[model samples]
Target chain A: MSPTGNRADWADDEDFDDPSVLPPQEVITNKDGTKTVISYRYNDDNKKVKVTRRIKTTVVREHVNPQVAERRKWEKFGLEKGHAAGPSFDTTSVGENIIFRPSVNWKANAKEAEKEGGEKGSMKDQLKDKKVKCRICSGEHFTARCPFKDTMAPVEEGTAAAPGVEAEEDAGGLGAGKSSYVPPHMRKGGAGGGEKMGGRFEKDDLATLRVTNVSELAEENELRDLFERFGRVTRVFLARDRETQRAKGFAFISYADRGDAALACEKVDGFGYRHLILRVEFAKRTT
Target chain B: MRPILLSGHERSLTQIKFNSDGDLLFSVSKDKIVCAWWSANGERLGTYNGHQGAVWTVDVSPNTILLATGSADNTVRLWNVKTGECVKVWEFSTAVKRVSFSPDGNRLLAVTEKRMGFNGTIAVLDISYGENLSAQAAEPTLTIVCEESKATVAGWSFLSKYIIAGHEDGSVSQYDPKSGDQLENVQIHEFDSQITDIQFAPDRLSFITASKDKSAKLLSSRNLAILKTYISDTPLNTASVTPKKEFVILGGGQAAMDVTTTSARQGKFEARFYHKVFEDECGRVRGHFGPLNTIDVHPAGTAYASGGEDGYVRVHHFDKSYFDFMYEVEREQARK
Candidate 1:
């Protein structure tokens, strides 16, 4: 069936069946002196497409010197002999627009613009007096790199246990008590749940199988084909070193159903591939 | 405003000049070719060929009938503007560094380099616009030898009364056009710094000099007295005075050899605009990737073009804001 709207002639219906042929373009002048052009072409999918465009033209007139006007008619010579009129793409191009406004205090305005662009400088100034006291031992370092991170809990655990008594103590010696840190899971009466870093993948954990002992030479496509015997695989993620681009002996394979995931884990745990035995199990949830 | 980029040269540009009518732009470069472009649309009109070495400078006659170029081939060649044909060639003992046409287009001056036991000299040739362009004088009418410091750039003063030349030792000297005798000499810039460019005002009463000392100075042509100074952060290669407005354009950056060691922002490759009377920088337009080698404003003062070491010529036409900017005192004077 012809999909174009308002076919004025019966001959237009016959052209739709023949994909190789296109109708001639039509141009119409409107009342406001605008032009409307309709043309037909074949798109990438080999389907016939019709394009309609409206264009307005304006003429700009400029007065130049008589000598300049005479020189404009000179012929191109040397390397550009007998070339087409107008600028060629290889020799001339329009650059990105630049906004230039003359001002009395241009240097001051430029400095302000630079300050706005480099936001890190202002942020450093705002954090000048702030200290980097660690949570483990109150050292001047990050909590993750602290020497006592693995051995001790946070230093203010007792104060967090008794908030009512600690409030009174905090009011008396505010500077001494640097125990204002709170975990995300314990904030706002502990009603809202904690937000995980990669929370979007939490729901897929049940149907995902963690595959370890993967050979460095094992490709993702080979692993997918090997695991496809048990179930329909939705995704396969292989961990690789950034520099060497070699597999890191670990991968994750997700299935459409939890039953298929369990079946694949049991069958693939003792399977041998690429001179290595694969060890597969259900993926554990990240804290 | 959007600039029109002309990429006709394959090597670093040495000089660029706009004709008196401000419709044609002539550019010479190290690529041994001279390209003439339409200033309005960036369309290349033609290329003048036949130079054996890198072209150093280019200038168009006031009548727009002849074009002259100096080159490292130790020769100066003139071309017919309409046909791009070499009309004549004048040979010298050393490479020609600069060339300029007189205000009335009746005389041409060429500055030759000092090399291989040859002292630097400024030679003036009489030009004729008769029916036969090639039947020109084979010898220079007069020659001025510089014993102390070589002349880098030279031009004629108003009414062709005095020939002003900028020296390699950062000094400017005025000489009698007929006698070839130095009338006055003054040190205008830092003592050992070389002057890179010298361009005259529309009336030729004064001129601006760009130097390696990171400053551009406007001086009176009659007595070589420094009138105004504009300080920049980078060594300037070229400076030009606008005709209809009270602004001067300065172009420069870090030296070309050190360009690869720094980023584009740190290189400071921009065309700076300064108020001629107030000596305050109004704004800057940045586009080139390397140091700017030359800059020329349109004779009508509506547009300007700059050539850089990156081998690109950018032509910019001013908008409303450029003409509307005025200081408080200037506005009050206009109101009166």
Candidate 2:
């Protein structure tokens, strides 16, 4: 109202005409709880209170489920299922190196196996396109005789320690990529053929026998009583040293004939004589 | 001769034998009762006592004064055959399984099973005294190991110069009496089981092994070579290589009346061959439904007896004609 005379003089006041009067200003409160003017027109405003923003602090908690240690984990579906680690619980999926290729591409709405009328797990179907491939060292050889199959596999052919595929990588060699292998029939057993029934017995006609025990050359009555049942015994000779007339630690019994001897051989070959094994054989025929 | 049921022991009869005259039969059993019976009339002549456990082996000396009995209790008790009294006792570490008299009748062969859990052992005692000192059961002259946990020295054969060892591994080993050298390890047919009984062929070159595997394997002592193999429907428990050197009789679980084979012969390439004498449809030796434990043809070849887990002693006659024996079997059936 500034001392406007009883009649407001409409004079051209230079200060009133200044545009700086509408300029913004700040109002701050003092420590004494008194309002203080921060700008040139602060004291002249109708309201002096200022607006301020407040800050707040908060906390939150979350729980995680128990997971097996990753280092000890192994992915096994069947044979190795009960093996070292727990079941597969993985964040990332591990898939076979399967690829989308020309051969894998099929006609739309087509079932290749169904087209052939073959079951999935059928032996014939399994053998349709797949040959007898070995599981190791993917070569034209059975796992048993694989040149690269050195140790650990049951039928390893070579005893000399061959470098493992992983070991070859460390050795920095031009390692061949492993694919699939061949089987025994595909590979030659010998120089050009295969093997058949026999181990050590292949050499001789004599069969593996059981000679249970050998006793002393005692009296004929005792000898006669024990052996007379199988067949008619032609001769019983207690093997003796020619010089000392002492028991040479054995005896020879001659059955009546070959059939009788064969039968006895079957019966007594491994029979125990006084905790010893009796060696039964066909005595060289004299007559 | 006809074999009548001479006598039966109340407890399981383990060993049976006849006196030289074949007049009296002596049987030692698990009941600790040693009974002497008159073979002619089934009369219990006398009873001897003192064995604490099952008597495993019994032998009669040629002189006839001594009746040596071996027991599972690990003691050899000498009894006067006539009096049926315990004359002497020889203590051992484990069960004394077999006892035999030397050909000379001067030394005693008492084969005992030591380390009861493992191997078969033999102890040969030198009793300088002929009939006076009780089986002079000396310190073991030789110790042989059969290696199997349940091995036992069953008997000494070949005139007491060699010891035969039976193994639970279905094998039999032999040792030279003088050298202690392991002469043989007979793989009785790879029986795949335990050997129930073994007997050395008298001539000492071969032996018979009856097994719990239902198969008997006769092995040659000379090379531990297998000479014969006998298959049966049930486990073969005991066998006797004939004193005639003619056959081997095997008795076992309800398989054969008992299977006997003819004498084995030496062949050109093979060790020896044996002939099948006869096979019986009935259970062997006419006894014991359970596992037959022991079978011995009287060293004299007159008759043999068998013992079994069923606790029965069964006696059989070899000389009985098939018809006469058949009549007897019929009579027994009629009685039943």
lDDT tens string, model 1, B157-252? Answer: 999999999999999999999999999999999997899999999999999999999999999998888899999989999999999889999999
For candidate 1, the TM-score is 0.71
Give the alpha carbon lDDT tens digit for every residue of B235-261 in model 2. Answer: 666676656424466665542333354
Off by over 4 Å in 1: A1-25, A40-42, A45-48, A112-126, A129-287, B258-264
Instruction: Indicate which candidate wins on TM-score.
Output: 1
| lDDT for position A212 in model 2 | 22
Question: Considering only chain B, what TM-score does candidate 2 achieve?
Answer: 0.75
Displacement of residue A251 (Cα, Å) in model 1 is 43
Q: Each model's DockQ?
A: 0.60, 0.00
The sequence of per-residue lDDT tens digits that candidate 1 reaches over residues A1-287 is 24466688898778778858788788989999999999999899989999999988888999877887888889999888999889988889999998999999998898788766654477777688799975433458887876544333221242234454444544444444456764434444322222231232444668878898999988999999988889999878776655788886877888988889899999999899899999998877432
Candidate that would win on DockQ: 1
Q: lDDT of candidate 1 vs native?
A: 0.88
